[model samples]
Target chain A: MTPAFEKLQKQLRQLPGLGFRSAERIALHLLVEKPARLPELVEALQAAAATVRRCPRCGNLAEDGLCAICADERREQGVVCVVEHVPDLVAMERSGAYRGVYHVLHGRLSPIQGVRPEDLNFEALFSRVADGGVRELILALSNDVEGEATCHYLTQHLPAPANGVEVKTTRIGFGLPSGGGVLYADSVTLKSALDGRRHYE
Target chain B: MTPAFEKLQKQLRQLPGLGFRSAERIALHLLVEKPARLPELVEALQAAAATVRRCPRCGNLAEDGLCAICADERREQGVVCVVEHVPDLVAMERSGAYRGVYHVLHGRLSPIQGVRPEDLNFEALFSRVADGGVRELILALSNDVEGEATCHYLTQHLPAPANGVEVKTTRIGFGLPSGGGVLYADSVTLKSALDGRRHYE
Candidate 1:
């Protein structure tokens, strides 16, 4: 291949989930269409890059210094949903059930990757909680290993107000499906089965 | 969803092959990453958009006015590989098989998509062929209905050469595989078989 084609292919592979075939498709689509759509795409990317800033208090992406949830005066100030990323915040919002402000962790703590307690936005969260404005600190992090670790770390740093403020961890309850088999269950799952066993009688 | 979230969903859907789930994943990946990566991605998109351009003659994407193949001194001037898109031309080039210059149609004759004969880069092909420099116009279009129709249209437009140059419609042949069945073939394949039938004692 020519230098230009090779360079394009290399750049295309950098995009998330884009393999050789997808890269080729994108390149060809641009070449064949005279690419009237390209300028707009570029403009969108630049605009998003320039304007999307992290909220100073929450760490969520925002067009301004403060995110929409933080800026909105109507949202309940007493509640805060702690999440690992902006997407999780977005996902919860999509459900249309939650109307509280959010705090984005940016990522979870993984000791294997050398990510310590100081590497995350723990300082921001501590300050947000220290003000004592929020009545509840909901640990809505993922159920994965790192997420569980981050939640444990947060609980330690978050000073429990002897007043009315409650610090709680939220989790999606696990149960057997209507048509699941016990024979195929793994060790961890089998252990949880005995711990939370329910009486059918 | 908020207006911003809705806008993001709409933008994700505009990209090729991105379903709602994939879009959500991409959005999450971008948002969760450090602000550093986002800026780099945005810059790359802008850079590619600004630098990539179409060759005036062959309609291939190039960093300059003319593509490398068109400007190359070693390629065969008497032959031109006609393709529906620059990507197909690149794909062929990547395989290191074709050594001739390429003429991109920009698109095929797809009636359902409102792509007419006049919509392609036909005028450029006609002018190049009429210049009496090319001998063979290889129909390297895809083995699809629209590609066949485009090849037929191009054939009718190409007149007898003014000079000693020979004008012919060349095609890469397709036949039954070395270890394949012929009876399961479609009508088009059957027709090709009959037209090129061999004589046996």
Candidate 2:
């Protein structure tokens, strides 16, 4: 391999989910196998980098102002789903189960990693809540310590609901995933599943 | 995802080994998590696309004239390894086994797919062989039908091994890979291993 090729591979390896071998394969694919696509990929990446920006309201990806979810009139603006990252928001969207918009923290409260409430996109969320249109806030964060801390911090800091109504706060439940067997389920998952059990007819 | 983000994801999805989910993750990683790295990636891609090109002599990646392998004086110029693609060349280089230069066909002879001799970098190879330097032509092509067809085509078209000496054409051997159990080896691999069995110590 040449210096330029190696440099390109190194850059590609820095991306998420790309190992050295996979990065090499991708570099070769772009440089040799389908050379024509390389320019297009570069153009697209530059275009996205120049145009895409954080949604002013929710911290999700946006081009001009708000993200598509925040800008859409059909989505429930009053019901906000809070997630740790944009990918989590994308995952929730993929499920098609949530009709509400999302608030991306970009990170959770990780004390060990020195991540604080101020380090995240918390101020905007607080402002959104304080502005007083939210009816419900669903915490769709991961079932981890940091996620719990973030959820706790958000609930503790929440302002009083508009019109003297109480704001309903909920957390996404943890349990065995679809198509997963109990025998293979971890103990924590099993415990959550047990705690979240529904009454049988 | 916004239009720019979606466009970026679609372009990423077209890359080898990236599925929809992985593409989405990468897009979010660039746009939201580590936005600073996006411009670097774009620059790298642009730089590679601008500077890198096929070595006119051997069809390997090059920045200016000859590829690193071809330009190197220490490498064995007389021994040329022919591979189906640049990634194969990169793989061989990674092993640190072969010290010779390479001839990347960029593709193989796939009659069914309408890949012909003219479609490959055969003429340059023939010219290199005809110009009188190559002593050994190692065929490191794949073990598939098209690979075999390509090897056969190259052997038949080779200009009388320069200086009237034998070209010493050889294909990469097929055998059970290191650390692989014989029982787990597929039938075709088993047959090849048996066929290529070495003499007793």
Candidate 3:
């Protein structure tokens, strides 16, 4: 392979879900689909790279040192939603419900992966809490093993539950669809279904 | 939504397989998990865009004006593999089976899509063949309807079988796995199996 093609392939393989075939497909797309856009995409890539920076206050990406979330005057400052990653930030934002700022943990702890507390921005988070303006910290980590572990680890560093600062954890509201048949239900799902039943008016 | 987050969402949505969910996922990927790699990937994207170009002779992407296949002195001079796009060229190369030059058609004849002969490099191909030396034209277009139509259209423009230029086409080799059953086969695959069957000897 030519150096250019080799380099392109190597770089493409680094992206998620891109194998050799998909890399070549994307490369061909860059070549054929509005060839002029190639330069523009390049410009966008470089601009995004050079300019994108994490907000010191909220961990959201911003063109300036502080992310847009941190700069926004209307967003609730004292109630911060802490998430494992930026996608979580976007997801919560997409719901268009949350009015508070976000603090991205970047990742959760996994002992198998050797991720320690220092590897994350836990110290900064503790400092943010200790400074005393924040009233609530909503832990919005995924409901998976690592997320659970990280949440537990984070709680240990927080002010005591009685210290007047409320620390709440969020989980998805999920269940069987209304009017769905129970004949096809599995045991665990059925159990959750029965366990979660509420009284009607 | 903050301007930066909104802008980022729009760009990520334009990427392949990136819907609202996937786009948010990528954003999170950028925000978290080796965030350093995101900038590097963006840089590589920009660099690839700046440097990659089409080979004048065959239309494959070239670091220089000519692609590696076109520049190589060792490839068979009289044989050319005609493909609808550059991705096909790369796929053929990946198998490490063929050492021949390629001519990228850029696209196929799609009446519904309004793609015509003039939109492709047909004129250049004819001129290249008439200039003398190419003895074989191998059609490696997709197995789709458009690819078949393109092969027929391409064959119509070339010299007759008597001109010492043989016209041939190839299909990918595929079949059921050793332990697989016929009931699982799709219609098109079953047809391919029957069409590609060989004598037991």
Per-candidate interface DockQ score: 0.31, 0.72, 0.27
Every model's TM-score: 0.73, 0.83, 0.67
Best-matching candidate per lDDT: 2
Candidate 1, after superposition: displacement of residue A158 in Å?
Answer: 1.6
Pitting candidate 1 against candidate 3, the one with the higher DockQ is 1
lDDT of 3 by residue, A94-187 (tens): 5555687878787779899999888886776777777775766766665567776887888776754435565553432234444332323344
**Candidate 2 clashes between residue pairs 3 or more apart in a chain or in different chains:** none
Residues A55-169, model 1: lDDT tens digits: 8988877775688889888898667877777766766566555667888787779889998888888888887776667766666555567776887788777865545466544
- Chain A vs. true chain A, TM-score per model, equals 0.77, 0.84, 0.75
On a 0 to 1 DockQ scale, where is model 3? Answer: 0.27
**B5-55, model 1: which lDDT tens digit per residue?**
345546655667677866665554554564465556555555566677777
lDDT of 2 by residue, B108-154 (tens): 88878999999999999998888878877777666666776888899
* Per-candidate iRMSD: 3.2, 1.1, 3.2
Q: How should the candidates be ordered by TM-score, best one leading?
A: 2, 1, 3
Tell me which of candidates 1 and 3 scores higher on lDDT. 1
1 or 2: which has the higher lDDT? 2
Q: Candidate 2 docking category? A: medium
